[model samples]
Target: MNIRQMIKENNRLQDAMTPDNLSYYQDMVVYIRSSAVQERQCEELLLEMARRLLDAQDKGKDAKDVFGNDLESYCKEQIERLPKRKGLSALQYHLMIPWIALTWFFFVQAIVGFVTMWAGGPVERMTQVRISTLILIAGGAYVLIHVLMKWMKSDAFKPEAAQRKISARNIGVYVAITVLILVAGVWLGRHLPVLVIAPWVSLFIFLIGLTGTKLLFSTK
Candidate 1:
């Protein structure tokens, strides 16, 4: 074939060898034509695409592994870049936040439960109203915790930030604890006021323990 005629035939054949076709002869011809420009080996692109597909499958199994690593890396960077004038040490400050959150939850729940009990158990048909209310409050708190975690997770380096997101979570836990205490108090208060004092004391104990744990871990 003449030079121009041969070039035209090659162009037509090259255009026909798309990835989806994987035709051997067509691929060989295109590979030769585009050798200088797209010098990748014949299967290079296909192999890379296969790797990406496998990676995607792995991510589907544990999306957290991909995003969580990024988040934790980001948090480390932020801590390292701090201006040093934030008062408390970075470790100390973040550590104490969870403790403070737990304490606040304990106190709030203790009060809510105490007040709820003091208002009298519940009406006849509304006997389960208190339980329902407590459940709703707890569910709402969980949602809030989830949202807060999602937002803080934007930092990409603080993957563990979500683990420490107990502010709203404490509310739900303490609320349940308080309700248990209130029920016990109501039952035992039939004879003495001692039962009324247990929940608060328990809450205080939990706060102390939580605070201690935070300090110990953060100091490391």
Candidate 2:
């Protein structure tokens, strides 16, 4: 199965677990999935682990007894055993992320065009977003998302310290990043050309993106 299919299957199996068991299972899921291990390997391990836990639960087994107390060590051992991708191998074939992102971006622009037309504006002048501004926006979005995801996964295994409150410092950092991105985007947008994308072109790009995802998201 593909990574997405395995992930869906794993999640479905986890629903059968007792609340306590599900919590324990989620710890393993978030940690390994957030790790540098290949996505396919993580899904495979999680799928097998979910099935094992369900079986153990049926026999009135305690999760701690079966998996032991050291969640970190157990997960690390499994990560080590799985095949590791070296250098570019780890970086390749993960095009679904960008493909889906761009698809949604264009799809939204097309929707905006529809909104403008309903208001009796020219569809050709739907958006005034410049190429450089788009790049800055996309880049900023990626960095912000990466930071947030890291914070989310950092304490996955440490359930005791799982509940995190955003402090003033964190808030300040986020605000600063937002301000910087806005400043850069505005400057670039003024200097660069406002290449207005026709709604039809955006729709076409969205269609192309759909085909790109089929080739990227699957190994076949």
Candidate 3:
């Protein structure tokens, strides 16, 4: 049958089935949708599977009997049998491991830094800061090495296309901001007690580390 015909049949079955059967069919639809099948193929397969499931329900069989004990696994096997489509290469996943590890390391550093600043004695705080810094540096080096390795070996690791040009006015604004921050930092360093500045600096570092880590690990 055509895709539309199959879909209509499935929907009719869905309407006719009991709530429990309907729920199982809905989950099957979700699994099929999420499988690595091509869009057109997925639609056809989903409807086909739904129709079969409905047939089994009509015969008084449970979902497990219709789709086997593991419906998702069955659907995945079927999807894999379809013709190959474009997907992420193994290199992409290999590169992601180091990146994700680095992101998690920085996240942990941020948490440790904050906790140490709030709870530790002077010596303990200094020690924690040093340890966190070392961890951050090590994690960064590991990620950089993996990134460089991928860049050397794979075209897929190359940087994306350039974004919009920064206008002359934006450059001037950025310079002004940099100068303002430097001036503020110097002023604060000279006027504020170390104890007062230290906690804020720690907090600022924690926030930046957390944000950078989150951005690095965020999925498209």
Candidate 4:
């Protein structure tokens, strides 16, 4: 199964745990996931842990006994033991965000261009790649890399029960940021040194980005 599927399965398995075991296991979940572990590797490790603990629980072994009483140390040890992705594979993995960002960023522009034509808005705005567009692309890549690198580490330090989960407010914040980028990009494209790109050119670049993203993230 894929990493996301494995994560979903792990969540499902949590339903079968005895109350006490579930609490201990979930603490481990938050801790391990919050650590500086690669996402695919982390999910694999968690799924394995889930099955092993579930089996032990069936035989009446408590989580503390099956793992250990020293939760922090145990989690740290696991982090040390886990394999790190390095070299080209690691580089490709990191490239995932930018490729995706380029793909969607242009895709959205293309749609906006079409909508503008329909609504009789400024036709030239869609074709102009502003200084802000370059800033947006570079800034977006930096922000995404920063967030991915820090997210788990940030959460690892939180109280287990207080760990952040994906919620509507968090999603709304993201949407707001995206909308701000689009508005700022359009406004800035008008004021300075801009490339005279056609809407079809934007569509072509968008397609290339989409194809590249698919290849970049495709499973080996």
Task: Write down the TM-score for model 3.
Answer: 0.37
Give lDDT tens digits, candidate 4, residues 21-74.
Answer: 888888788888766677788888888888989999989898888788877677
Q: By lDDT, is 1 or 2 better?
A: 2
Model 3 alpha-carbon drift over 4 Å, by segment: 1-12, 88-220
Report the lDDT tens digits of candidate 2 across residue range 46-122.
98888888889999996786789988789889898887643233343333444466687888888898788788987
What are the models' TM-scores? 0.24, 0.67, 0.37, 0.62
Q: Could you tell me the lDDT of residue 111 within candidate 1?
A: 60
> Residues 6-49, candidate 1, lDDT per residue (tens digit)?
55544554453333322322322332332222223323433332
Worst 10 residues of 4 by lDDT: 161-170
Once fitted onto the true fold, the runs of candidate 1 whose alpha carbons sit more than 4 angstroms away are 1-84, 122-197, 202-220
Clashing pairs in 3: none
Candidate 1 at residue 202, lDDT? 38
Write the residue-wise lDDT of candidate 3 on 1-220 in tens digits. 7667766776876797677667666766766655456666877777777677778888888777877766556766887888544555575545455455544554565566566667764534443333333333444545555644433333221222311132344456557655665565566556544332244455565566556545554443
Candidate 2 steric clashes: 0
- Higher-ranked by TM-score: 2 or 3: 2
> Considering every candidate listed, which one attains the maximal TM-score?
2
Q: Point out where model 2 deviates above 4 Å.
A: 1-22, 32-65, 82-99, 122-124, 165-173
